[model samples]
Target: MLVFILNAGSSSLKYQLMNPIIKKVFASGICERIGIDGVLKHEYSEDKELKLDIAMPTHKEAIEAVLSTLTSGEGKVIDSINDIEAIGHRAVHGGEEFSASILVNDRVIETMKKLIPLAPLHNPANILGMEICQELMPGKPNVAVFDTAFHQTMPDYAYMYALPYDQYTKHGIRKYGFHGTSHFFVSNEARQMLDRKHNTRIIVCHLGNGSSVSAVHDGKCIDTSMGLTPVQGLMMGTRSGDVGAGALQYMMHQENMTIEEALDIMNKKSGILGISGKSSDLREVLEGMQNGDERCRLAVDMVAYNIKKYVGSYVAALDGVDALCFTGGIGENAALIREKVCAGLDAMGLVLDPVKNNKRSKVARDIATNGSASRIFVIPTNEEYVIANDTFKVVTESR
Candidate 1:
C-alpha cells in the first residue's frame, strides 16, 4: 500500500511516501519553518534532491506545496495526490486513551485534542496535520500512529508517579513515555539480530535532539526514561531532562518567572546548549571539546555519563539486558559519544569494540566484543516505517 506519513511539528512538517509491503520509498521530504518563510526539501529519487524556497504561510499552503511537488512539479513522484492510498499522522501523545494505531475518526480527533495539554508543543501540530489531510484528501483513510502507544504496556509501578492518587485519576498525570515508535522499531530489530525475538530483553537508546532510553522486555515496554512528557529522560538538545522540581521552583522564585516562562527556558534554552554555552547540536559540542573547550567537554561528558547511568539502571530493570541497541541521529553516527557511553561497562557485560564503534555504516550491526555478555548494536531508527506499517495495517484491516 502507498502510505503518506506526516510528522508535523510546531514549525515544520516531515513527510514520507512509501510502500511498506514492498519496502520501497517513493518520496520523502520536509517542509520547514511553516508560519514563517519556508524551505521545502524533497527527495524524489534516491540521488536527486531539491531545495526550494517557497511561501508556506501555513500548513495548508505547505501541504498544497507538497501535493503540487509530488504530482506535477519537478520533484513529481506520483501522478496525483490520489495516487497515495492512505495518510498516516505521527500523533505525539495518545495519553492512556489509545494503545495502538487507529483509523482517524471524530472520536480519535477529539481525543487527540484532549491530549493537547499533555503534549502542548506537538499535539496541536499533529492534529492540524490530520485535519488538514482529511480536508485535502477527502476520501483517503487517515491513520493515527501514536508515540505513546507502544509504551502503554509499561507496568503501573513503572509508569505511575509518587504523586497523589487523585492527581492521576483526575488529570492522568503519569509517565506516558514518548518515542514509542522508535524504541519499538529498533528493539525489534535487535531482537531479530540477537535471535531472541520471543523472550528478549533489549535497551534502546534513541539519542536524537530529543533523546530517550527504554527498557523493552519480551517485546513490551517495561520502563522508559521519558515520563509524562518528553522532558524527563536523557538530556536532549534543548531540554533540561531529569531536572529537579525544587531547582525549577528555586529559579522561578529568584527570577519571578511564570510556569510557562520557566518551561520555555527549560525546554528551549537548556540542555547541551545551556551547558556548553553554544549550539544544541552535538557536532558543535564535539568540535568544541576537540578544541579543549571546558564547558563543551563537560557537556559531552555529562551526556555520556547520563546515558551510561540509564543503561545501568535499565539493565537492572530488565534483570538482564540481552542487547543494548542505539538508534536515532546521535546514536547511529556519533561514535565518540557511543564509546564514552559504553566505557567502563565491561563489568556490566556491555563492551564496545573501538574499531567497530568508530566505523560508519547506515545498516544495523553489533559493536560489542565477543566476550561481552549482552550484544551492543547501532540500529538506525525508521520511525516513518513503523507509522506507515501501522497505517497500512489499520487501513487494510478496516477494509
Candidate 2:
C-alpha cells in the first residue's frame, strides 16, 4: 500500500510517499513559506532535487502543488492519485481527547476543531491540511496520527500540574507531552534491537532543535520532559525550557511586558540563544566552544547538565532503568553530547565505550562499556514511518 504522510506546520508542509509493505519510499519533499512566494522541494529516489519557485498562497495551493509533483511524468513517484492508498498526517496536539491514532472522520475533524485553542499554533494547520487532502482525494482514507497520542499512557500524577484542582478541572491545564511519536518509535526500536521483551524500562531522548525525553516503563510512557507545551523541559534551540513561574511575573513587573511578549521571549529568544548570545544550533555552539568561547561552552554545559539531571531523575522514577536510548538529530549524531551526558553516569553503571561512541553508526548499536549495568544505545527515529504504519492499521482495520 502506498501511504502519503504529511507533517504540516504554520509556514511549511513536509510529505513522504512510501510503500511500507514493500519497504520503499518513492518520493519525499517539503513546501516552505506558504501564503507568499514559496519554494517547493521534492526528491524522488532516483532523481535530482526538484525545486520550484511559485506562489503557494495557501495550504490548498501547497497541497495542489504536492499532488502535481507526485503525478508528474518527470521521475514521479506514483502514476496516479489512485496509487496512493491512504494518507497519514502528523497532528501535533490531540489534547486529552485522543488516546490513540484514529481514522479521520467528521467526528475526528470536529474534535480537532475543538482542540484548536489548546494547540493554537498546530491544530489549525493540521486541520487545514486534512481538509485539503480530503478535498483533493475525495474518497481516499486518511488517518490522524497524533504527536500527543502515545503520551496518553502517562499517569495522572505525572501529567498534572501544581495549579489548583478547580483550575485543572475547569480548563484543560496540564502537561500533554509532545514528540510522542518519536519516543514511541525509538523505545520500541530499542527493545527490538536489544532482543528484550516489549515491556522494558527505558528512557528515550528525542533531542533535536525541539527536544524531549520520555521514560518508558514496560513500554508505557510513565513520564516525559515536555509538559503542557513544547516550551517546557530541556533547554532547546530557541526555547528557554523550565523557568520558574516567579521569573515571568518579575519580568512582567520590571519590563511592563504583556503575557504574549513574555511568551515570545521565553519561546523564541531564549535557550542556547539566550545564554550564549549566539546561534541556537548545537553544532554552532560546539564550534564556538572549540574556539574557546566561554559563553558557548557554558551553553553546551547547561544542555548536558539539564539532560543529565533528567536522566538521574528518571532513573529514580523507574527505580532502576534497563537501558538508555538516544534518538533525534543531536542524540543520534552528536557523540560529544552523548559523551558529556554520560560522563558521570558511571555511578549508575552506565559508561560509554569510546570506540563505539566514535564510530558514528546510523543503525542501532550499544555504546556502553563492558561492565556497565545499564546499556546505552543510539537509535535513529522514523516518526513518519510510525505514522504511516498507524495509518495503514487504522485504515485497513476500519474497512
Candidate 3:
C-alpha cells in the first residue's frame, strides 16, 4: 500500500510517499516557511523536481498545494489522490494515552487536543496536518505515529520522577522520552547487524541538534535519557540539557526573571551556544575548536563527557550492553564525537577501531575492533520508514 507520511512542524511540513511493503520511497519533499512566504520543493524522483514559491496562509493551503503538485502532470507522483492508501502523521507527544501508532478517529483527535499542553511546540501542527488530511481524504485511513510510542515500554520506575505522587497521578507529569521513533528504528537495525539470536542489550545514542540515549534490552526500552521533555537529556545544539533545579531557581532570584524568561534562556540560549558563545552547529563548533577556541573545545568536551557518562550508566542499567549504536545527524556523521565518546570505554568492551570509526558509509556497519567484546555500530535512522510501516500495519489490520 502507498502511505504518505507527514511530519508537520510549526512552520514546515515534510512528506514522503512510500510503499512500506516494498521499502521504497517513491517521492519525498518538504513544504517550507508555511504561514509566511511558502516554498514547496517536491521531488518525484531524482531527475524530476519542482519548486514553487507561493503564499500558504494556513496549513490547509500547504496540504492542498502538496496534493495539487503530487497529482499535477508536470510533477506527478501519483495518478490521483485515491492512489494513496493511507496517510501517516508524525505526532510528537501522545502522553500516556497512546502506547502505539493507531488509526486516527474522533476520540484520538480529542485525546490529542487534550495533550496540547504536553507538546505545545509540536502536537498542534501534527493535529492540523491530520485534520486537513481527514477533510481532504475523508474515508482514507489516517494513522498517528507518535514519537513517544516506542519508549512507552519504559517501566514505571524508569518513567516516574521522585516528586509527590499527586503530581504524576493528577498532573500526568513524568518522563516521556522524545525521539522514540529514531531510537526504535536504529535499535532494530542494530539488532539485525549484530545477528544475535538471544535477547540482546543495546544502547542507542541518538545525537543530533537534540540528543538522547536509550537502553533497549531485547528490543524493549528500559530507560532513556530524555525525561518529561526533550530538554532534559544530553546537551543539545541549543537546549540546555540536565540543568540543576537549584541553579534555575538561583538564576530566577538573582536576575529577577520570570519562569518563562528563565525557560527561554534554558531552552534557546543554553547548551553549546551558551557554552561557546558561538554557533550552535557542531560543524562550526568543531572549526572553532580547531582555531584554538577554548570555549568551543569545552562545548565539545561537555557533549562527549555527557554521552560517555550516559553510556556508562546505561551499561549498568542493561547489566552489560551487547551492542552500542550511534545514530542521528551528529551520531552518524561526526566521527570526532563518536571517537571522543568511545574513548576510555574499552573497559566496557566497546573498543572503537579508529580506522573503521573514521570511515563514512551510508549503510549500517560496525566500527568496533575485531576483538571487542561489545559491538559498536553506526546505523542511520529512518523514522519516516517506521511511520510508513506502522501506518501500513494499522491500516491493513483494521481492514
CA lDDT, every model vs. true structure: 0.93, 0.90, 0.93
Q: Considering only N, C-alpha and C atoms within 3 Å, which residue pairs clash in candidate 1?
A: none
State candidate 1's TM-score: 0.99
**Model 3 off-target regions past 4 Å?**
none
Give per-model TM-scores. Answer: 0.99, 0.98, 0.98
Q: Is candidate 1 or candidate 3 better by TM-score?
A: 1
What is the TM-score ranking, best to worst? 1, 3, 2
Return the number of clashes found in candidate 1. 0
lDDT per residue (tens digit) for residues 1-399 in model 3: 999899999999999999999998878899999989999998877668888997898988988888888887678878899999999999999999999999999999999999999889999999999999999999999999998989999999999999999999998999999998999999998888888746899999999899999999989899999888788989999999998899999999999999989989988999989999998899999999999999999999999999999999999999998999999999999999999999999999999999999998999889999999999999999999999999999998999
1 against 2, candidate with superior TM-score: 1
Q: What would the per-residue lDDT of candidate 1 be over residues 1-399, giving only the tens digit for each residue?
A: 899999999999999999999979989999999988999999988888999999999998999888898998789999888889999999999999999999999999998898899988899999999999999999899999999999999999999999999999999999999999999999899989998768889999999899999999989999999998888988999999999899999999999999999999989999999999988999999999999999999999999999999999999999888899999999999999999999998888898999899999999999998889989999989999999999999999999
Highest TM-score scorer: 1
Stretches > 4 Å off in candidate 2? none
